[model samples]
Target: MFPYAAELIAYAAGAALLTAVGGRGLLLISGLGVAATLGVVGPLLARALRGAAAAPQPAPALT
Candidate 1:
Protein backbone atom coordinates (compact mmCIF):
# COMPACT_ATOMS: atom_id res chain seq x y z
CA MET A 1 0.00 0.00 0.00
CA PHE A 2 1.17 3.50 -0.77
CA PRO A 3 0.77 5.10 2.60
CA TYR A 4 2.90 8.01 1.42
CA ALA A 5 1.49 9.52 -1.73
CA ALA A 6 4.30 12.06 -2.06
CA GLU A 7 6.90 9.31 -1.88
CA LEU A 8 5.10 7.31 -4.56
CA ILE A 9 4.88 10.32 -6.89
CA ALA A 10 8.53 11.25 -6.42
CA TYR A 11 9.72 8.24 -8.40
CA ALA A 12 7.80 9.32 -11.52
CA ALA A 13 9.02 12.87 -11.21
CA GLY A 14 12.59 11.68 -10.77
CA ALA A 15 12.38 9.44 -13.82
CA ALA A 16 11.03 12.29 -15.94
CA LEU A 17 13.81 14.51 -14.72
CA LEU A 18 16.38 11.87 -15.58
CA THR A 19 15.01 11.50 -19.08
CA ALA A 20 14.75 15.20 -19.71
CA VAL A 21 18.48 16.10 -19.60
CA GLY A 22 20.11 12.77 -20.40
CA GLY A 23 21.72 11.37 -23.53
CA ARG A 24 20.36 8.47 -25.56
CA GLY A 25 21.15 4.70 -25.32
CA LEU A 26 21.87 4.38 -21.61
CA LEU A 27 18.87 6.43 -20.75
CA LEU A 28 16.74 4.17 -22.88
CA ILE A 29 17.97 1.12 -21.04
CA SER A 30 17.35 2.76 -17.67
CA GLY A 31 13.90 3.76 -18.85
CA LEU A 32 13.15 0.18 -19.89
CA GLY A 33 14.24 -1.15 -16.51
CA VAL A 34 12.11 1.38 -14.72
CA ALA A 35 9.13 0.60 -16.91
CA ALA A 36 9.62 -3.12 -16.51
CA THR A 37 9.85 -2.81 -12.76
CA LEU A 38 6.68 -0.78 -12.69
CA GLY A 39 4.91 -3.20 -14.98
CA VAL A 40 5.70 -6.06 -12.64
CA VAL A 41 5.11 -4.32 -9.35
CA GLY A 42 2.29 -1.95 -10.18
CA PRO A 43 -0.48 -4.58 -10.36
CA LEU A 44 0.64 -6.38 -7.21
CA LEU A 45 0.87 -3.08 -5.41
CA ALA A 46 -2.61 -2.14 -6.54
CA ARG A 47 -3.99 -5.45 -5.26
CA ALA A 48 -2.35 -5.00 -1.90
CA LEU A 49 -3.55 -1.43 -1.70
CA ARG A 50 -7.11 -2.10 -2.79
CA GLY A 51 -8.66 -1.80 0.68
CA ALA A 52 -6.00 0.38 2.22
CA ALA A 53 -8.25 3.39 2.53
CA ALA A 54 -11.55 1.64 3.06
CA ALA A 55 -13.57 1.71 6.24
CA PRO A 56 -13.29 -1.18 8.64
CA GLN A 57 -15.75 -4.03 8.18
CA PRO A 58 -17.76 -5.74 10.86
CA ALA A 59 -17.76 -9.46 11.31
CA PRO A 60 -21.03 -11.33 11.19
CA ALA A 61 -22.15 -13.15 14.35
CA LEU A 62 -22.06 -16.93 14.12
CA THR A 63 -25.28 -18.58 15.16
Candidate 2:
Protein backbone atom coordinates (compact mmCIF):
# COMPACT_ATOMS: atom_id res chain seq x y z
CA MET A 1 0.00 0.00 0.00
CA PHE A 2 2.76 2.40 0.83
CA PRO A 3 4.57 1.74 -2.41
CA TYR A 4 1.40 2.16 -4.43
CA ALA A 5 0.54 5.37 -2.65
CA ALA A 6 4.04 6.71 -3.08
CA GLU A 7 4.00 5.86 -6.77
CA LEU A 8 0.69 7.66 -7.23
CA ILE A 9 1.86 10.72 -5.36
CA ALA A 10 5.12 10.83 -7.28
CA TYR A 11 3.33 10.56 -10.61
CA ALA A 12 0.83 13.25 -9.67
CA ALA A 13 3.59 15.58 -8.53
CA GLY A 14 5.58 14.93 -11.67
CA ALA A 15 2.60 15.66 -13.86
CA ALA A 16 1.84 18.87 -12.00
CA LEU A 17 5.44 19.99 -12.23
CA LEU A 18 5.62 19.22 -15.91
CA THR A 19 2.44 21.15 -16.56
CA ALA A 20 3.60 24.11 -14.55
CA VAL A 21 7.04 24.24 -16.18
CA GLY A 22 5.88 23.66 -19.78
CA GLY A 23 9.35 23.34 -21.28
CA ARG A 24 11.41 20.62 -23.00
CA GLY A 25 14.09 20.43 -20.29
CA LEU A 26 11.56 20.26 -17.48
CA LEU A 27 9.66 17.61 -19.39
CA LEU A 28 12.78 15.47 -19.51
CA ILE A 29 13.49 16.07 -15.85
CA SER A 30 9.94 15.21 -14.83
CA GLY A 31 10.01 12.11 -16.99
CA LEU A 32 13.25 10.96 -15.34
CA GLY A 33 11.80 11.59 -11.90
CA VAL A 34 8.75 9.51 -12.71
CA ALA A 35 10.85 6.70 -14.13
CA ALA A 36 13.15 6.70 -11.13
CA THR A 37 10.23 6.63 -8.72
CA LEU A 38 8.76 3.64 -10.49
CA GLY A 39 12.11 1.90 -10.71
CA VAL A 40 12.50 2.10 -6.95
CA VAL A 41 8.89 1.56 -5.89
CA GLY A 42 8.26 -1.37 -8.21
CA PRO A 43 10.99 -3.61 -6.73
CA LEU A 44 10.02 -2.72 -3.18
CA LEU A 45 6.40 -3.51 -3.83
CA ALA A 46 7.27 -6.78 -5.50
CA ARG A 47 9.49 -7.86 -2.63
CA ALA A 48 6.90 -6.92 -0.02
CA LEU A 49 4.18 -8.81 -1.83
CA ARG A 50 6.42 -11.80 -2.27
CA GLY A 51 7.26 -11.83 1.40
CA ALA A 52 3.59 -11.68 2.30
CA ALA A 53 2.82 -14.59 0.02
CA ALA A 54 5.68 -16.63 1.44
CA ALA A 55 4.55 -16.29 5.06
CA PRO A 56 3.86 -19.48 6.96
CA GLN A 57 0.31 -20.78 7.32
CA PRO A 58 -1.11 -23.22 9.85
CA ALA A 59 -2.41 -26.55 8.75
CA PRO A 60 -6.11 -27.44 9.18
CA ALA A 61 -7.08 -30.10 11.77
CA LEU A 62 -9.11 -33.09 10.69
CA THR A 63 -12.24 -33.99 12.68
Candidate 3:
Protein backbone atom coordinates (compact mmCIF):
# COMPACT_ATOMS: atom_id res chain seq x y z
CA MET A 1 0.00 0.00 0.00
CA PHE A 2 1.15 3.52 -0.70
CA PRO A 3 2.25 5.67 2.23
CA TYR A 4 -0.91 7.67 2.83
CA ALA A 5 0.61 9.08 5.97
CA ALA A 6 3.46 10.65 4.05
CA GLU A 7 1.08 12.10 1.52
CA LEU A 8 -0.98 13.62 4.29
CA ILE A 9 2.08 15.07 5.95
CA ALA A 10 3.16 16.60 2.69
CA TYR A 11 -0.25 18.11 2.20
CA ALA A 12 -0.16 19.57 5.71
CA ALA A 13 3.28 21.04 5.22
CA GLY A 14 2.28 22.51 1.89
CA ALA A 15 -0.83 24.04 3.38
CA ALA A 16 1.12 25.56 6.23
CA LEU A 17 3.52 27.11 3.79
CA LEU A 18 0.73 28.46 1.65
CA THR A 19 -1.12 29.83 4.67
CA ALA A 20 1.98 31.59 5.83
CA VAL A 21 2.54 33.07 2.42
CA GLY A 22 -1.05 34.33 2.25
CA GLY A 23 -1.59 34.85 5.97
CA ARG A 24 -4.95 33.06 5.84
CA GLY A 25 -6.52 31.26 8.80
CA LEU A 26 -9.07 29.35 6.72
CA LEU A 27 -6.36 27.66 4.71
CA LEU A 28 -4.62 26.61 7.87
CA ILE A 29 -7.83 25.10 9.22
CA SER A 30 -8.51 23.27 5.99
CA GLY A 31 -5.00 21.89 5.91
CA LEU A 32 -5.29 20.76 9.51
CA GLY A 33 -8.56 18.96 8.76
CA VAL A 34 -7.01 17.10 5.85
CA ALA A 35 -3.97 16.18 7.90
CA ALA A 36 -6.11 14.99 10.84
CA THR A 37 -8.24 12.73 8.66
CA LEU A 38 -5.20 11.25 6.99
CA GLY A 39 -3.56 10.67 10.36
CA VAL A 40 -6.65 8.79 11.58
CA VAL A 41 -7.17 6.65 8.49
CA GLY A 42 -3.52 5.83 7.67
CA PRO A 43 -2.84 4.12 11.01
CA LEU A 44 -6.11 2.21 10.88
CA LEU A 45 -5.34 0.84 7.44
CA ALA A 46 -1.77 0.06 8.39
CA ARG A 47 -2.94 -1.86 11.45
CA ALA A 48 -5.45 -3.82 9.38
CA LEU A 49 -2.81 -4.65 6.81
CA ARG A 50 -0.35 -5.60 9.53
CA GLY A 51 -2.70 -8.31 10.74
CA ALA A 52 -2.94 -9.73 7.24
CA ALA A 53 0.81 -9.68 6.90
CA ALA A 54 1.20 -11.59 10.17
CA ALA A 55 -1.38 -14.24 9.25
CA PRO A 56 -0.09 -17.70 8.48
CA GLN A 57 -0.02 -18.29 4.76
CA PRO A 58 0.36 -21.68 3.13
CA ALA A 59 3.97 -22.36 2.25
CA PRO A 60 5.61 -25.22 0.44
CA ALA A 61 7.52 -27.51 2.76
CA LEU A 62 11.14 -27.79 1.72
CA THR A 63 12.13 -31.42 1.91
Candidate 4:
Protein backbone atom coordinates (compact mmCIF):
# COMPACT_ATOMS: atom_id res chain seq x y z
CA MET A 1 0.00 0.00 0.00
CA PHE A 2 2.77 2.38 0.87
CA PRO A 3 4.67 1.37 -2.23
CA TYR A 4 1.61 1.93 -4.33
CA ALA A 5 1.15 5.34 -2.82
CA ALA A 6 4.73 6.23 -3.52
CA GLU A 7 4.30 5.09 -7.11
CA LEU A 8 1.14 7.13 -7.50
CA ILE A 9 2.77 10.23 -6.08
CA ALA A 10 5.80 9.84 -8.29
CA TYR A 11 3.68 9.37 -11.39
CA ALA A 12 1.45 12.28 -10.58
CA ALA A 13 4.35 14.57 -9.87
CA GLY A 14 6.14 13.46 -13.00
CA ALA A 15 3.07 13.98 -15.12
CA ALA A 16 2.52 17.43 -13.71
CA LEU A 17 6.07 18.46 -14.32
CA LEU A 18 6.11 17.04 -17.81
CA THR A 19 2.90 18.81 -18.67
CA ALA A 20 4.27 22.12 -17.45
CA VAL A 21 7.71 21.85 -19.02
CA GLY A 22 7.19 19.70 -22.09
CA GLY A 23 10.25 17.93 -23.58
CA ARG A 24 12.84 19.50 -21.32
CA GLY A 25 11.39 17.87 -18.23
CA LEU A 26 11.35 14.35 -19.61
CA LEU A 27 14.88 13.40 -18.55
CA LEU A 28 14.33 14.57 -15.03
CA ILE A 29 10.96 12.85 -14.81
CA SER A 30 12.38 9.65 -16.18
CA GLY A 31 15.19 9.67 -13.65
CA LEU A 32 12.77 10.36 -10.84
CA GLY A 33 10.43 7.58 -11.97
CA VAL A 34 13.29 5.10 -12.08
CA ALA A 35 14.57 6.15 -8.70
CA ALA A 36 11.14 5.97 -7.13
CA THR A 37 10.43 2.56 -8.63
CA LEU A 38 13.74 1.17 -7.48
CA GLY A 39 13.34 2.68 -4.03
CA VAL A 40 10.01 0.92 -3.63
CA VAL A 41 10.74 -2.31 -5.46
CA GLY A 42 14.23 -3.03 -4.12
CA PRO A 43 13.19 -3.29 -0.49
CA LEU A 44 10.02 -5.20 -1.31
CA LEU A 45 11.97 -7.68 -3.36
CA ALA A 46 14.61 -8.08 -0.67
CA ARG A 47 12.01 -8.61 2.03
CA ALA A 48 10.09 -11.10 -0.06
CA LEU A 49 13.23 -13.05 -0.89
CA ARG A 50 14.30 -13.04 2.74
CA GLY A 51 10.89 -14.26 3.83
CA ALA A 52 10.94 -17.00 1.24
CA ALA A 53 14.40 -18.11 2.33
CA ALA A 54 13.33 -18.18 5.93
CA ALA A 55 10.15 -20.16 5.37
CA PRO A 56 10.28 -23.86 6.27
CA GLN A 57 10.63 -26.41 3.52
CA PRO A 58 8.72 -29.66 3.29
CA ALA A 59 10.45 -32.98 3.87
CA PRO A 60 11.39 -35.05 0.85
CA ALA A 61 9.21 -38.06 -0.01
CA LEU A 62 10.52 -41.57 0.53
CA THR A 63 11.80 -43.41 -2.54
Candidate 5:
Protein backbone atom coordinates (compact mmCIF):
# COMPACT_ATOMS: atom_id res chain seq x y z
CA MET A 1 0.00 0.00 0.00
CA PHE A 2 1.07 3.60 -0.50
CA PRO A 3 2.84 5.01 2.55
CA TYR A 4 0.89 8.28 2.59
CA ALA A 5 -2.39 6.43 2.12
CA ALA A 6 -1.60 4.22 5.06
CA GLU A 7 -0.81 7.26 7.21
CA LEU A 8 -4.06 8.95 6.25
CA ILE A 9 -6.02 5.81 7.02
CA ALA A 10 -4.39 5.57 10.39
CA TYR A 11 -5.28 9.17 11.26
CA ALA A 12 -8.88 8.78 10.14
CA ALA A 13 -9.24 5.56 12.04
CA GLY A 14 -7.92 7.20 15.17
CA ALA A 15 -10.26 10.15 14.92
CA ALA A 16 -13.22 7.86 14.37
CA LEU A 17 -12.29 5.72 17.31
CA LEU A 18 -12.00 8.76 19.52
CA THR A 19 -15.34 10.04 18.37
CA ALA A 20 -16.95 6.76 19.36
CA VAL A 21 -15.24 6.94 22.72
CA GLY A 22 -16.83 10.34 23.45
CA GLY A 23 -14.11 12.73 24.36
CA ARG A 24 -14.78 15.94 26.35
CA GLY A 25 -13.13 18.45 24.03
CA LEU A 26 -11.91 18.82 20.49
CA LEU A 27 -8.41 19.38 21.77
CA LEU A 28 -8.39 16.09 23.64
CA ILE A 29 -9.81 14.18 20.72
CA SER A 30 -7.34 15.73 18.36
CA GLY A 31 -4.47 14.87 20.67
CA LEU A 32 -5.57 11.27 21.01
CA GLY A 33 -6.01 11.00 17.29
CA VAL A 34 -2.48 12.16 16.74
CA ALA A 35 -1.13 9.64 19.25
CA ALA A 36 -3.10 6.83 17.68
CA THR A 37 -1.99 7.81 14.18
CA LEU A 38 1.62 7.91 15.27
CA GLY A 39 1.33 4.51 16.93
CA VAL A 40 0.28 2.92 13.65
CA VAL A 41 2.35 4.96 11.21
CA GLY A 42 5.42 4.89 13.43
CA PRO A 43 6.20 1.26 12.69
CA LEU A 44 5.75 1.63 8.96
CA LEU A 45 8.03 4.66 8.99
CA ALA A 46 10.65 2.88 11.07
CA ARG A 47 10.62 -0.12 8.77
CA ALA A 48 11.11 2.09 5.75
CA LEU A 49 13.97 3.93 7.40
CA ARG A 50 15.65 0.68 8.32
CA GLY A 51 15.29 -0.73 4.84
CA ALA A 52 17.76 -0.21 2.01
CA ALA A 53 18.44 3.41 1.07
CA ALA A 54 19.57 2.54 -2.43
CA ALA A 55 18.85 4.85 -5.36
CA PRO A 56 16.29 3.89 -7.97
CA GLN A 57 17.52 1.57 -10.70
CA PRO A 58 17.73 2.73 -14.28
CA ALA A 59 15.35 1.44 -16.95
CA PRO A 60 16.51 -1.47 -19.09
CA ALA A 61 17.74 -0.84 -22.65
CA LEU A 62 15.45 -1.86 -25.55
CA THR A 63 16.22 -5.21 -27.12
Candidate 6:
Protein backbone atom coordinates (compact mmCIF):
# COMPACT_ATOMS: atom_id res chain seq x y z
CA MET A 1 0.00 0.00 0.00
CA PHE A 2 2.73 2.45 0.93
CA PRO A 3 4.65 1.51 -2.19
CA TYR A 4 1.69 2.30 -4.39
CA ALA A 5 1.15 5.62 -2.70
CA ALA A 6 4.81 6.47 -3.15
CA GLU A 7 4.55 5.53 -6.82
CA LEU A 8 1.60 7.84 -7.29
CA ILE A 9 3.52 10.66 -5.70
CA ALA A 10 6.47 9.95 -7.93
CA TYR A 11 4.27 9.90 -11.01
CA ALA A 12 2.71 13.22 -10.13
CA ALA A 13 6.07 14.80 -9.39
CA GLY A 14 7.44 13.54 -12.69
CA ALA A 15 4.47 14.78 -14.62
CA ALA A 16 4.75 18.18 -13.02
CA LEU A 17 8.46 18.39 -13.73
CA LEU A 18 8.04 17.28 -17.31
CA THR A 19 5.32 19.77 -17.85
CA ALA A 20 7.50 22.48 -16.40
CA VAL A 21 10.57 21.60 -18.46
CA GLY A 22 9.41 21.73 -22.12
CA GLY A 23 5.66 21.65 -22.48
CA ARG A 24 4.66 25.22 -22.89
CA GLY A 25 2.40 24.37 -25.81
CA LEU A 26 0.34 21.92 -23.80
CA LEU A 27 -0.64 24.50 -21.24
CA LEU A 28 -3.81 22.69 -20.23
CA ILE A 29 -2.21 19.37 -19.31
CA SER A 30 0.79 21.02 -17.71
CA GLY A 31 -1.34 23.36 -15.67
CA LEU A 32 -3.57 20.52 -14.58
CA GLY A 33 -0.63 18.36 -13.57
CA VAL A 34 0.91 21.14 -11.54
CA ALA A 35 -2.38 21.76 -9.80
CA ALA A 36 -2.89 18.08 -9.09
CA THR A 37 0.58 17.69 -7.62
CA LEU A 38 0.13 20.71 -5.41
CA GLY A 39 -3.31 19.53 -4.32
CA VAL A 40 -1.94 16.16 -3.22
CA VAL A 41 1.30 17.25 -1.59
CA GLY A 42 0.35 20.55 -0.03
CA PRO A 43 -2.12 19.20 2.48
CA LEU A 44 -0.01 16.19 3.36
CA LEU A 45 3.00 18.39 4.14
CA ALA A 46 0.87 20.79 6.11
CA ARG A 47 -0.62 17.99 8.16
CA ALA A 48 2.78 16.43 8.83
CA LEU A 49 4.29 19.74 9.93
CA ARG A 50 1.29 20.47 12.11
CA GLY A 51 1.55 17.08 13.75
CA ALA A 52 5.23 17.59 14.42
CA ALA A 53 4.53 21.00 15.91
CA ALA A 54 1.76 19.57 18.08
CA ALA A 55 3.93 16.85 19.60
CA PRO A 56 4.04 17.22 23.38
CA GLN A 57 7.12 18.87 24.85
CA PRO A 58 8.90 16.96 27.63
CA ALA A 59 8.20 18.34 31.10
CA PRO A 60 11.23 19.53 33.07
CA ALA A 61 12.11 17.41 36.10
CA LEU A 62 11.75 19.13 39.46
CA THR A 63 14.92 19.21 41.52
Local distance difference test scores for all models: 0.78, 0.89, 0.85, 0.91, 0.81, 0.85
TM of each candidate vs. truth: 0.45, 0.55, 0.48, 0.61, 0.44, 0.50
Candidate 6 overall lDDT versus native: 0.85
Q: Lowest summed lDDT over 10 consecutive residues: which window, candidate 2? A: 21-30
Query: Poorest 10 consecutive residues of model 4 by lDDT?
Result: 21-30
Which model scores highest in lDDT? 4
Of candidates 4 and 1, the better by lDDT: 4
**TM value for model 5:** 0.44
User: What are the per-residue Cα lDDT tens digits for candidate 5 across 12-51?
Assistant: 9868866776656656877888999999999999889767
- Please report how far candidate 3 places residue 5 from its true position, in Å: 29
Counting clashing residue pairs in each candidate, in order, gives: 0, 0, 0, 0, 0, 0
lDDT of 3: 0.85
* Alpha carbon deviation, residue 26, candidate 4 (Å): 0.9
Best by TM-score: 4
Model 4 residue runs over 4 Å out of place are 1-22
> Candidate 6 residues 1-63, lDDT tens each?
999999999889768767776556456666888999999999999999999999999999999
Q: Report how far residue 58 has shifted in candidate 4, in Å.
A: 0.6
For residues 2-62, write the lDDT of model 4, one tens digit per residue. Answer: 9999999989987887888887678877788899999999999999999999999999999
The parts of candidate 6 lying over 4 Å away from their true place are 1-25, 59-63
Tens-digit lDDT track of model 3 for 1-63: 369988999889877777676647657777899999999999999999999999998998999
Q: Which residue pairs in model 3 clash with each other?
A: none
TM-score of 1: 0.45
Look at candidate 6 and tell me the lDDT of residue 63. 100
**What global local distance difference test value does model 5 have?**
0.81
